[model samples]
Target chain A: MTTLSNTQELPNGPVAAALLAGGAGAAMLGLATTLAEASAGVKNLLVWFNPVGPLSGKTGVAVITFFASWIVMHLIFRGKNVNFARATAVALTLLFIGLMGTFPPFFELFVKE
Target chain B: MSISPREGWTVLHGMLFGAAFLLAFAGGFAGLYSLRPEWVTAEGIKERILRLKVGLWAMALIAWATVISGTYIVYPWYRASDATSARSILLADPATAAWHTFGMEWKEHVGWLAPIAATVVAFAVTYYGPALAKKVGERRALMIFFVAAFATASIAGMFGAFINKVAPIR
Candidate 1:
């Protein structure tokens, strides 16, 4: 019987890839918000980007992004070796950028003129 | 200007949507602690962990939904030109004006942290938890994640309630 150590067992390729994908997906949503604000065309297409409107549209976008990325990552990492640390670093960078992208809408909504 | 019916429903839905996710997370944590390695069958432990993992994703989804809805509701309420500011809106009614000073000022800022923290915790647990727990006793890692998640959820709830009370649907 082959006994695998916990370190070698946990967060296998699929899991690491899923995490990285989720982060990237969230970043895309954040970037979308910025794009919606910067371009009138995007704003019209993604009305949910409106700071004053109902958030269902934006929520829907985020949901799509999450699942889409998860699926893509699952496929890409399937039967492949993954470096969890490197994947995490890349994902965190995307998430951070996405987070920064979200600021404009928050600013427009909260701060008084 | 009064909130549109669409925005109102979004806020209402977001508030109600939180209950199920909260229950999932809290229950998952409780179950984790309740399991005794010596007593529970290995299969039983795996099932529990699987449920907990699902809870992590559900928690993240709920956090995002709630944040989006709450922001939609509160942003316009905050920016209503007639009101000038959140404090001013509350000041319009002295009876509830005290809330503005109590913590409403920081509520939005603090509220923003909930989704961020929840997402991070979800990803952390999903990806790194098992391996990390192996390094730092399993019980301690589980406890740490639970505490952080619970704190974020509590803050999310508190600020949601505070914002609704101070600003209201209008």
Candidate 2:
């Protein structure tokens, strides 16, 4: 073990941005998955690519949400500190929603007969 | 023995890219776990940080590659509407229908989370660099993200393997 006398401190904003954005992206995917099951319109709308079917749109929306949210949050919080703990909690909640949304047993509940 | 084009792509996506990400997880996890100011000297951190960055970035990239290839290439074949398609074969029989309904459904969506989470972890680590060692809370959060990435990938890879065994995409 070694002790360091000097360690530079950087703002936590960027990390917070990443965490939040990741969660947002994941939540979006889950939302898309569940919605696709709930409505035929959503399922068809998500079919961005023919071969890949609705998966293309589902993932496309997620990728877009992740990057877009990241950029927006980064710009707002750049070089600044925020409540890291709060950010983490929110992100985790979003992630949980994402996980549940993707699970077939869970999403299938929304399926229309 | 020679393999068909579809088989070759399947091998490349699952065996090459997916396996590489899974295999690298141990090293990355260990590095992240041990990345503490008390655990290593300043000089030691410099060395470990470089290796960690490289490994994390590689894992992230490989994850992206795996999903993209799986989604755009192999998935089309597996999900084709033809009677011989993997999805059709699985759905054609009640015994195997659950593989598509449950296994494949969870795998495809959850698999995507791995790359997204991984990229976030990679970016955070690179952004923080050696300073990450001192920030205990931040480091812990990153570890959670890393573990999440690994867990999601494992689910996808496992189901992918099982699904292929049950009904290959050929």
Candidate 3:
């Protein structure tokens, strides 16, 4: 019965803006790599997706974003009858796609081989 | 249900180990008695034989218990959904869909039942830790660690929606 928003605050004001900020960051990194390496088409595509950062990584900003999310989830899910933790985890994962999909620094290191 | 395919691996392993130990014990008795009949004596042989039989019975009981617990692990795979249910949930291609579900369910069962009971129980413990923490906080958490670990593997399998993953994203 516990929805993702239940007992929880909306993440960081506007979700859209935050997601874009993250996405753009990733895109730039991809473009940067392309520019530095001398490749064109692949560079552009990489740049395009780069802004999103690495969504499924261990130590990147991606992880930080999720860790923040986990903290928030734990607080909201503390005593509710429904499964707030799982719901929040799902919500966090979606939000992270944008946040993690971007950011080159996060991508270069955190993601696993 | 009571009778499920999840028990298959559990049954196999249990039977293997149980039979191995039983054989070893039997061989031990035979070797000792055959090597010495007078000094070892008939009374000694009788006592050894009884001990060996008790050991076999204990092994048999444990093996049976493995078969029982295995049902839950197997249930999700072979018993959870009938063919019709799986077909509807999966992709348009029935063959691919069936194979997909089979693999996914197999992965879940393997992740849950195989390791902990046979190899290491810790694997299940970590997987279920968070969910359990949410349910009961820190108090009885440790006790449920093993159960949580095992169940979490199954939960992950169910959550993975392996069929969907394999289906074309388009």
Which should have the higher DockQ, number 1 or number 3? 1
Each model's lDDT comes to: 0.55, 0.93, 0.33
Question: Which order, best to worst by TM-score?
Answer: 2, 1, 3
Which ten contiguous residues of candidate 2 chain A have the minimum total lDDT?
A1-10
Q: Per-residue CA lDDT of candidate 1, range A1-113, in tens? A: 21113234553456555556556655665666556556656556765545554233444566577667777887888667676567656766765654555554342343332
Model 2 segments more than 4 A misplaced: A1-3
Alpha-carbon runs more than 4 Å astray in model 1: A1-11, A48-58, A104-113, B1-15, B19-47, B50-54, B57-159
RMSD of each: 7.3, 1.2, 22.3
CA lDDT of B78 in candidate 1? 58
lDDT of 2 at B152: 92
Q: What is the lDDT of residue B133 in candidate 2?
A: 86
TM of chain B vs. native, candidate 2: 0.98
Listed in order, each prediction's TM-score against the native is 0.55, 0.98, 0.21
